[model samples]
Every structure is written in structure tokens, then in C-alpha cells.
Target: MHIAEITAVMKLPSNVRYEYFIKKVTDFEEVWGLFSDAWATSKDEDGNLFIPFFPKKEFAEISAEKEWALYKARSISLDDFIEKWLAGMKKDGIIPSIFPLGNDMAAVSIDVLLKDLEMELENY
Candidate 1:
């Protein structure tokens, strides 16, 4: 199957966040226009990554009891297009997520504008 857009959601603190377009990827208007949910979790967790596990689980488990599992998607191989897009995006300003990088307190964001990622399974 063909992938339209890729979004990698990550959590972050309330400050030091992304606030601009890194690159103008073609056919990613829908992804660019839509705002991805990112934020910090409660102060009880070991890590501050505020990932809502429900959505992830919904995209996993293929069972006889749910349809949300239909949203699950898998890739066949990491295509060169993804690398090219990421390189262009990095050059344009999109950088690696800072969750485990530079700072500990920063706003969360998603940055998967990679292109032409072949899908082996697009249950979604």
C-alpha cells in the first residue's frame, strides 16, 4: 500500500518547543495542516514523555473484539525517499526529538514528514 503521510508523535515539556514549518514536503498538506497532540504527563512517572497509550494500543492488537485495531500500520522497508525527505527536512530545520537529547524540559512534537515509505500492512 501507499503511505500518504507519516507522523511521529512525541511528548515534551510546556516550553522550548517547535513553532514553525521545517520543510514544505509535497503531498503532506494534510499532515502539515493537522495538529498533532503532544504534552507532558503527570509528575509521578519516571519519564516526562506524555504518550497516550490508548491510541498506540488501538493501532496494535488485532483481536476479535475491536475494530480500532484496524488503524494499525506496518512498514515493509525504510525507503530512500524517507531518508531524502528527512535530510531535506533537517536542512530546512526539522531536527531529532529532544526527549532523550539536549534538554529535559521542552514541548512535545511529531516530525515524520518522510516520503514514499512502502507499507506491508496498512490495516488503518
Candidate 2:
């Protein structure tokens, strides 16, 4: 499947916010590569670097479940995205860990825009 946009907003324990974007990824592997590259290049406000988790089909599926319309309408919360959608993905082994970035009190928000790639991808 193809995705036009995926946005991940991470609110770290230190109250620092990090936003990651994935655009026009054609498959799960591409998503993994892009996420890895972004994490490798990312630095905190203090210039501390952190590693990123490898993207899996489960991660893509979690992204897919996000309703862009609802998010745009401001009807979703970062806590809901983590407690509901991401928690489900974790059960399915899509996410390696709930707190991959090591933020004890982190919250994640995801927004996804799906592309019609004629692959019968699932959307939630």
C-alpha cells in the first residue's frame, strides 16, 4: 500500500515535542528505512541523539487506523492514540515497545493520509 502522509507527534517526558513525518512511502520497508534515517539524524534540544525503532507492517497498520478527518477536526487526543490505537498495534507486534524513545511519560499522536494504490489496504 501507499501512504501520502504520516505524522507522528511525540511529547517527551521533559515536555519536549518531536514531530516526524513520512511522506509517499510505497511499502512497509520504505517506511522502516525512512523512519530509521530520520531517527539517526534527529537530535534533542540538548543535541542528544536517539535510535529509532524499525518500522513493521504493524506500525503501518497503526498509522492506517488513524482517521485524518477526525484528527483535523480536533476530535482525537494524543492519549487516545497511544492508549487505543498504538496499544492495539503493540499487541499484534507492530510496535517493538510502547516507549521506544525511552520517554517515561511520553504521549504520541499520529495522523495518516492514505493513498489509493489499488492494493485494498485497510483504513480505520
Give all TM-scores, in the order shown.
Answer: 0.20, 0.20
Query: Each candidate's root-mean-square deviation in Å?
Result: 14.6, 15.3
Which residue pairs overlap in candidate 1's backbone?
Answer: 13-106
Model 2 residue-pair collision total:
0
Q: Residue 60 CA error for candidate 2 (Å)? A: 5.9
Give the number of the best model, judged by TM-score. 2
Pairs of residues at least 3 apart in sequence or in different chains that clash in candidate 2:
none
Candidate 1 deviant stretches above 4 angstroms: 1-77, 80-82, 98-124
lDDT tens digits, residue span 3-119, model 2: 432233333332232112221222321333113112222334665433232233333334222221121111223334335634554454332222233333222322221122112
Please report the candidate that would top lDDT against the real structure.
2
